[model samples]
Target: MNARQGAATSVHVASPPEFHAVTGRSFAAGTPTKSSQKSDDRLTTARLWQVRADPA
Candidate 1:
């Protein structure tokens, strides 16, 4: 699906910091499956709310 389609299907789920951290770690570990890659692709292309680190 394209970015617009992905954005349309995406939900607004509030995740904790740990959730994002673990997901980042998992991707960093490079053991993602095809499904995981698809998920990652959706996330990257969709217009989703993300947790941004404080630039303090």
Candidate 2:
């Protein structure tokens, strides 16, 4: 999911040795931003992905 999609209700991620190096912050919600529509450019460079679950 992109940051513009709003906060995720929940997330599950697999642990990697260098996970922290990629994601500067946890995948939690409520990140400071001028606009929610702003594309998360950091994610591209960081090479991080937002994990989500399939609908039940």
Question: CA lDDT, every prediction?
Answer: 0.40, 0.40
Cα distance off (Å), candidate 2, residue 9: 13
Q: After superposing candidate 1, which stretches have Cα over 4 Å from the reference?
A: 11-56
| Clashing residue pairs for model 2 | none
Superposed by TM-score, candidate 1 places the C-alpha of residue 41 at a distance from the truth, in angstroms, of 24
Candidate 2 structure quality by residue, lDDT tens digits, 5-56? 5534223222444443544344544332243433457765344343333333
Candidate 1, residue 2: CA error in Å?
0.5
Instruction: Please report how far candidate 2 places residue 38 from its true position, in Å.
Output: 1.3
Per-residue error at 40 for model 1, in Å?
19
RMSD of each: 12.2, 15.4
Q: Which stretches of candidate 2 lie over 4 Å from their true place?
A: 1-14, 24-37, 40-56
